[model samples]
Target chain A: MKKIKQIFYLGIKGSNSFLAASLSAGNKVKLSGLASFEEIFRSVEKESSAAGILPLENSLSGSIYEIYDLLTDSKTFITAETEVRINHALMQKERTGLQKIRYCLSHPEVFRQCRRFFSDNPSIETVPVADTASAAKMLKELGPDTACVANPAAAAVNNLRIKKEHLEDNRNNYSRFITVGRKLKQHGNKISLMFNLKHVPGSLYKALSPYARLGLNLTKIESRPIPGRLWEYLFYVDFELNNGKHGFDEIITAMKMLTKNLKVLGRYDKYDKIKNS
Target chain B: MKKIKQIFYLGIKGSNSFLAASLSAGNKVKLSGLASFEEIFRSVEKESSAAGILPLENSLSGSIYEIYDLLTDSKTFITAETEVRINHALMQKERTGLQKIRYCLSHPEVFRQCRRFFSDNPSIETVPVADTASAAKMLKELGPDTACVANPAAAAVNNLRIKKEHLEDNRNNYSRFITVGRKLKQHGNKISLMFNLKHVPGSLYKALSPYARLGLNLTKIESRPIPGRLWEYLFYVDFELNNGKHGFDEIITAMKMLTKNLKVLGRYDKYDKIKNS
Candidate 1:
């Protein structure tokens, strides 16, 4: 019998990261949990896990910047990518009237997504916890007067009763997750890279022009402050090209010449959007 | 006697926004407090306040993206700008040893800046509140066992003892603020604008080229999702040119042709960085 690879994620059972990890690895892998993104990265680096899964960005709230900062300094490569449609559910230990619930607990990011719900229930005191699943667990321990906003899967895992479904203000909210490991998977058409360009007029335009000239599709571009350097930015870009293209090497060579520092993070398949069954 | 203009900001008496508002409006203006950015905008729109002050970006943590999104949707023009040096301090009601402090209260953004302090005292429980000044007020009510991370000015306002000064990991942290009002302030050299380009391979590069061609210094660029449009972005840009220069009208006309939707948010003077008085 073959040993199953252990996959690590940030949060307890049934959190979004856990669901993303399961989707990325399938049934052959065993899922484990860690307390923080730092811990998950350390576990993967130490060979205790096959890959670490993390949410990279959310459609409504924007990018998970800490993960972006971590990617800049870490040697890990993105192995896979997936998207999870976020469906926040309000859960409690027992069935109680909405007016009776006095406290709400969840991760701060989840709170931002449920602004409408919070505004409607202004009397409910909100408390931030480490993660959504942990909030569900805490709600279970706190009993009837307390509730939490998390996923339905988390409510099921914690044996809590769902009081409200689709609690997010925007039903279109989706989180994009990426799996990181020691080696590149190298099978996908989409490529992600980070680079620092000289601060000058048209420097970014020059650095990005080669892709445009090559007729490549630029999907996303983001800039973060280079650490210890005020006002200087490191740009992260995602672009797509056919893997069998002939001039890919020449393009890479040209990009290197245009940038002061550049690193190819990974090439990975774009996850197909999973529609509701 | 000249009627005093009212300025609104987020948080209580001694928050960073309060200080920024004071610095931007000068002594002749009366300062008012609001609970959130939405309220500030509403007050400005309703003509209850002469202007609204908001933090646009931080050097260490990147953009205050919510403000960026608000600016994109708002008709209010940026009339003035200033930079405030951030100096976070840990405060308590009494002189208590660091080992005795059990709870830490602060705004979530402040917590991110004080990661080193949190890691050093891992046992301290962190609680998120609406603003740093409110956190200081809460800490005072909670007595000596609790400490809050806020500016030294907040500590002075709330009558809390500063247990530790300069708690932020990076001393270079500074927040740039912009004042929004009904009319543009035309005395300054810097101009801010927001626009949307048709999404394509080189759309952003094309949109940004005019500034480079005219030798205008591009100071900042950010993108936020156009409301109700998935994956489409509205770009915010800041550029500087000599206020007395010729061809300004021609540059504006050319830029208008390049973008689908364009609006000049404001033109404002660059704030001189005050280095510890």
Candidate 2:
């Protein structure tokens, strides 16, 4: 039994709600703290943790690049992954009815996440809060006249009543969360690397050329702005290969000679579809 | 004289801080209402606006694509342009010393605007408020312990005192604000367009090849996800050319069949720098 005492998360209010449910579902990992990106990184650096969960990307808003940067910056190896289906529950204090709810409090992302819901209900004012959790906290503190569209967890934590559930217009809405810890765990079938190729034209194509020849399917290729480099970028990629294989070695060798700052984060299993019993 | 009574803005908090200063520079144009991107568009659709100011792009944070979409979605035309040399002032209630400040409030954009500032002062927690003006509003409501990095106007509006001025890490920080109204004011000489090319290999290059050949310098190119079209994008571009014998007609001709849905919002001159004098 892994006595997972502390799990640090940098996420929205609903993230905490979902996390609480997840933690309870698993080995009862104790909720130690909730911090923003910077704070969370600082804490992880100082202490050991069972897992640190952070949002990597959203379906609608594209990627949350900052979180990705932090993951690389801290050198914390991604240990596991989780996917929480986002159901942005529109809620207020139990006392406040739908008519009395004047303002909708949410993080800008949450407001965006629930764009269709707001478009359908254009009469109510939607105010961007700092985070979904903070909005939930504020609603609890400010009371019923103000409703919030956030995660079920946020409503649970903040003690607000959900007036409406699954308010996110898209039923397939989901955010991918990555769990990182000190030790690298090999799932034995994936390679994730971040690198910057020389910025000449076709450099991206050139870097991927070797992989293409080997028939290695590139699962993900994301470009993030390299600090201090104008228009140049560092690409984080997840390719379907392991460190031990001969083909993987050839590709890695070619990539190293062909790019700048080639870093191998780890080899992990590709997250296939979630299974249900 | 035009009695421009209302100003509608599609921005997060702190976004209008610089503009707030400009608006406070006179008493004529009052901020009638504040709303998100969707609300602002709906309001403008129902009636004409005095001036609608929206942050078009940031040097560091790329472009605000939603605003561009709003511009395209409506018949409102770009009338004037302005640039605010951003100075993120850290403010708290008058008497609160810097050491006493625990939580920092600002828009997420402003938080990114002043990332280094917060990093250097690690003890202070950052709370992303919705609007720069609202950050000030929150600072005033929360009082001394909370400081915010916002525009001087926000400080003035909320009656908060500037604990420290020019707190943004980047000295060259500026945000371009576009003033949209019903008709082209014949002031701005630069034209902005939104269009999309076929999503084929070298398609982007082919689209821009004409601009490079014609000696037309592109001021900006930003990609916005085409709604419901996975991975497809609409490119928002600003091309600089005087409407003269050098007829933009050539470039228009080049783009005639090359791109899809090419709509010229309006042509206007780059703004004269706003003066405190």
Candidate 3:
């Protein structure tokens, strides 16, 4: 039998990261929790875990910006990708009625998703906690008058009752997670890379023209500022190639000559299904 | 005598928006406070105020995403722009020492800017409040063991003693603010616009080539997702035009033909100096 792989993610049980790590490829996967994204990357660097899972972007919120910055600065590469549908639940202790709840606690991002819910219940005060699962844990300790907005999995793990399900205003909420490892894995059609261009007119256009010339489909383009350099940006681009890696080397060579500090972050297959089991 | 213009901003006295509103070009600027960004925009639309002041982006924390989304969705136009240097200070009740500060309250973004301070003092718990000024107001009511991270103006307004000045990790921290009004102001060197482009290989490059071809200097480019569209993005671009609206009409006409849903958000002069008074 193959040995189980150790995977580390941010937050405790019933968190979105936990769910994402569980879905990552491995016959027998052992998931561990870390306090911050920095610690997760450090653990991967230390070789304590085979891989680390992190949320890259959300369909509702534009991007998990801190993760983008970390990916740009770190040495790790994405090995795989997965998507999970976010379904937030309003949970509390048993026998707590809707009118009895006065405060709602959860992650700040979670609160943003449930804006309409809070607007409907104007009396309930929003309290920002560490994460969704920890908020559920804290809600269990608090009085019956308090509730938490988290996933149903978190409510079950913390022994709380779900008063309202699918509290997010948008029903099509989804988040994309990436598995990070030490070495680059090359079994995918999609490639993600980051590069810096000079602050000049049409510099980005010239840098991105290679994709169009080569008939590759560009999926996403995001720009983040370089630390200490005001107005200078590091552009992250994701593209899909249907053909084999025939002209990939030449394209990358030409791209490097056109742009500065070009780094290929990952080449991974895009996974969109939610594997709850 | 010229009539005073009523300008609304976010937060109470001594907030960054308050300072930005004061800098608006009016004979006598009558500044008012609003609880949220939506309220400020609504007040501007209702004609209760001549304009609204809002922070567009920060050098450290990137863009104020909500404002970006609001600008894309609303019909309001930018009248002026200003830059404010962020100098966060740690403050508490009279004579409270650093050791006595068991908890520090401020906006989540402010906490991010002061990461080094919190890492050095790990024992101090960070409490997320509404905003920096409100945190100072809350700290005044809380016990003496609590402190808040805000600007010196907030500390002075709330009667709190500044224990440590310049708490932000980066000394060059600055935020750009824009004044929003019903009509577009003409006296400006910069023009900001937003448009949507298809997810094609050279879609963005083609949309931006007009600027380069017309000898216009592009200042900034940011992309935000369209609400229901999964992969499509609305690109926000800022460019400087040296010639006085000479070829601007032709450029806009060509840009509209190349891009989808092109909208000119504003035209305003860029302000970079610190004008606290």
lDDT of 3 by residue, A146-206 (tens): 9998887787778888898888877766777998887776567888888888777678778
Give lDDT: candidate 1, residue A150.
Answer: 85
lDDT of 1 by residue, A1-277 (tens): 1232988987689788876776677677889998677787777777834778998876555666677667766767887788777888888899799999999988776777677889988988888775678788877668578999888778888899889988776676677888888775546778888888656667877787787677676677766655456556777787777455734466678889998778888778877674220
Q: In model 2, what is the error at residue A78, expressed in angstroms?
A: 2.8
Model 2 native-contact share: 0.09
Measured with DockQ on alpha carbons, how good is candidate 1? 0.37
Q: For candidate 3 chain B, which ten residues in a row score worst on lDDT? A: B268-277
Report residue B103 deviation for candidate 1 (angstroms).
3.0
Cα lDDT of model 2 by residue, A39-151, tens digit:
66666567664566666654444445566666677867765555566777888887565667778988766676577778777778988766677778777667556788777
TM-score of each: 0.88, 0.64, 0.88
> Cα deviation in Å at residue A259, candidate 3?
0.8
For candidate 1 chain B, the 10 contiguous residues with the lowest summed lDDT are B268-277
lDDT of each: 0.76, 0.64, 0.77
Worst 10 residues of 2 chain B by lDDT: B17-26
